[model samples]
Target: MTDHPYNEMPRSDDNQSLFRPVAVGGRGLPGNLALAPMAGATDGVFRAICREQGASLTCTELVSARGIRHDPGWARSWRYLAITPAEQPVAIQLFGADPDDFDYAVRAVLEHPVLSSAFAIDINMVCPVPKVVGTGAGSALMRDLPLAARVIRSAVAAASGYEVPVTVKFRTGWDAATADTPAFARMAEQSGAAMLMVHARTRDMMYAGQADWSVIARVKAAVSVPVFGNGDVRDGPSAVAMLRETGADGAAIGRGALGNPWVFAHAAAALRGEAPLPPPDVAARAQTALREVRERAANLGEARGVRESRKSLLWYLHGTPRAAETRRRAAVVESLKEVERLLADWESSFFDKNGAVHFT
Candidate 1:
């Protein structure tokens, strides 16, 4: 449906394999490619970078239900809470299981001026992280359909007087043998979710094996609301295949966009019937990384901002020609000057000769 061009495009009913602007809170979201709410990764600065590079929608890292109540300033103080004016339509994701706690979490989120202005409220019901599931939230919700539905309904009620749309992200159930994405999708839609995001993997997998796109297809078949497939979408072709193979409404990219913010833009272009553009060259990527640090530091203070950004720098340089050496240098980088020095020397070898990224 979207005109973006990938290496291989699949044909289907016009309604079935296309990119349509999803409207939340009566606003039209641009690209079909949405960023996943990866914990400690999808912070506000990173979200802005990806959005600038062309992500249609972005989500905040998962926040705890209890954390919000305990720390009234949690959302306000989080680096991800500092969104730029341009990255509108982003969603803040929250995780928790207790019905009362869930309600309290919603109230906390609504208190933030920036958060309440979001296009949608995303409920994270599918995170596979042990710390998250251990508390009966995240993937643990898969085992209790009734409770999960209640949580969703409670969140929806919090927005009763508002127009903000409610969306849910979930996995393929607790395990491979017991995949229940279809059932969950039905429950989410029936309970009031305007959108459903399927991660295509089970809680047990936990980033192990490849995501089962077939499961995504099944969820899409079972749900009338838009179904965005997530998992293993590290490139334009993969994004295209996920759409084709699963007939998903869109994609929710996570690790893939870490070092490669261009993924969002390239994927958007590919989806729009154009040849994919290459990622920035080493020099350009390094410059972008530096700019990101500066921007984040400006907003979050220098010391903590640069320190919090170390992992992302390593991600961008991962798999470059001299990645091992680059990673070695990045790991030891304690200051912005050190980061700049490392990228200065490694730029030539790590970046493509012609400045095109080859994710292959």
Candidate 2:
């Protein structure tokens, strides 16, 4: 273990806000680490947790542009775009193929009450999920450059009169084995993308195998906008390595932060050349799990939060002893009391040869 465990606490507001700020679309985000928007996760409460932990900014789960245009009241899509003051500098990411629908979605966001806090808007072009891909959206856009350009154009036009910065998050190409990501990155810039986040994988590759950082470097060299590298950035050193290796501007944390938001906290410190805090102990994990559940419950209400937080509660114990057994019990928990009991017991059993959740 490194001699310095990041145990850093809240510094003054002015100090934290200015620490290695990242520039996105002419605006400075508070830090360099951003939480990658997960489809089922990354709600308001979750976003807040990541920010509190040290992530400078975060994206909303991919909201469907077509769905929003078709039914503005669709709870699943538009509702995810919810932003708050504490989560300022948040970007709401949109997906879907219809350029007209994307226009509609952008207008809707600008007109919403939350418009004032909407930091930036991001377009999703890299998701490998089949349902999204089937819609000619997500990674499918990588293959259809013309349509991708059109949708991006629409988003840019819609936000043109406003101060909101428009961005894109996409994949390397349709094929991982033969990626032409640099061209795509240039296209995104020409199409008015103020910043770009590239998941260094191809469409066919899905989430398997390693992310190609070389593509990220190529993209960075080709574009003037800020480039945030995605895929395989699991911790501080890797985050730093991505920036160093690719010459990219920032690192967006995805599955690496599932159970450990501290990855963001540590990443913030690492980016600023400071020591990161130690990994959370078992007790910290249990408390955070409970706090997240309650916060989710508060934001999404009782039923939804309880249902949604179940997976997260289990995720919090990823490398703990008897994790497999506890994960099973966590899945079917009927009440908050049961969740409390399970986590409380798990907290008591934190002892292992090493203190961290992972042994590898």
Candidate 3:
């Protein structure tokens, strides 16, 4: 495998404060490392795995507040909001354009026995997807600050009754030309948001280009509440660099955590001025990938689970020998048995005479 800078140690003094507990309303996270919510990736099973791997906090995929308002029985949104005890200190994220929808959705979540246990109710104003933005939700809210404030207030009012904190996640602005995170941070705080998470990219930038972390520092300066910096924090050194540079209370891992939950452990260790554990070997990666797929199959039916697991399996197999061919085979796997066989074959092919495995 190519050498990665994540394996390097970060300067101790610059990152000493990176691992402290952060308070959000009544909840206190054990550490500042959080697994940022990803819609298609962070399911209940994967959140549990991330938590075990060292994420101090995890969030569910963004659920539609309007959808929840319509499905009082949670028929459509249960899969997205499902949380297990193993993933405690988890947050349930909601997205919607209307204040009334958030009011209704927050109450419904608190009334439900299972979901009520979530550590916080996170409002999504960072998602840049066209479908979400077209509805005046997600990053579109950044363009309408007045409406965003009302939405935050509505959710805060609804959740405060249940003693649950309401947090907001947003981008710098619609684009670099209009970036104004400091102003948005103050408005959210005034609207009763208990904490803030700032993704340093604008909606127009989506996931491309370098993240301007200076925006996070500006937001941190504008708000008294805990703020997490999200964007491009892929490993231990990057996590420390974000904290040191932005003075953010935490670093939230989004795409960085895909198929590499160990990023959390490594970040935590680096924040504590220690060396990170070695990266997982081929055997361990194969086993964990198989376990995730099996658990997904148990929760969702086999067909859907196998279909959904393809991307994650490929992520885990990345950098292994013959990864291109293996990933091509993994993409068309129709059954769990086929997945198991594929992994076994790949693992067997990599082992040398000394029983050591090499990855490219």
Candidate 4:
């Protein structure tokens, strides 16, 4: 492991406590660990698994406010906003450039029977993708503070009537030269955001480069609202370091949580000043992967679910023996049965004459 201080395990006497409940408006999260909203990776099944695995809060993937306004029946957005009862305290994240669309979208969410019960309404200003940024939404809003304030005001106003909190997630700035996250935090808080989450990279950096935790620290100092630090938080120590270094109220795990829902459990343990559970063995990884595939199959039919699960299946097999070949076979799996056969064969190879797992 690298000698970075953040990557070092925390000691029992490290004054930096990582776990705590955060109050966001009328709702209260049981702990500070949250699953950051990811566009395609965090499906309903994965969200539920993360919740079960110890994520105190979860967020739906980014949904388009304009799409919600156009499809009031939720015909097109249901897949992204689908939150099961098991994933309670989930937030529905909406992204759009227009304040009017956010106003309508927040109202629409509050009116829906199932969605009305969400823990909070999260607004996305952190996504750095081209399509989203090209439309003056996502991180593009960072360049226009006035418009960003208006959008937050619109969402907060709409959700206030239902006693639901509004949260904003954003990058540090449009680029390194214009890094003004503290100012952005103040604007969001003044605009009535109940909570703020900072992904410490600039729009130009996208997902590359080291996230500057100093920005998150500045943001926490700038706003009274709870601040959650996201980016590069891969495990317990990094989560703790984010809290320790930034004084953030929480740590939000994004790519770190893919195929490894146990990250939440490990984070929780570290927050409690305890040793994290050992990493899952190959059997455990395969089992969880199968469970996710089965649940997805049950929800979205076998053919589609298995097809969609290809990437996740590959993630589960990462670092294992013959991973390249296994991933190659997994890439084109079109049915649940095919996945099962592939996993069974792959798993069996790990066993010896004694039926015990033996890694070479």
Error of 1 at 259 (Å): 0.7
lDDT of 3 by residue, 25-71 (tens): 97899998999999899898889998998999999999999999998
**Which portions of model 4 show Cα errors greater than 4 Å?**
1-16
Q: List clash counts for every candidate, in order.
A: 13, 3, 0, 0
Poorly placed runs, candidate 1 (over 4 Å): 1-17, 24-26, 75-77, 80-82, 348-360
TM-score of 2: 0.89
* Cα lDDT of model 2 by residue, 133-198, tens digit: 998999889888899999999999998777788999998898956567888888889999988999
What value of lDDT does candidate 4 attain over all alpha carbons? 0.89
Off by over 4 Å in 2: 1-19, 351-360
Worst 10 residues of 1 by lDDT: 1-10
Q: What RMSD value applies to candidate 2?
A: 6.9
TM-score, each model? 0.89, 0.89, 0.95, 0.94
lDDT of model 2, residue 231: 94
Report, for every candidate in turn, its global Cα lDDT versus the true structure.
Answer: 0.78, 0.80, 0.89, 0.89
lDDT for 321 in candidate 2 is 64
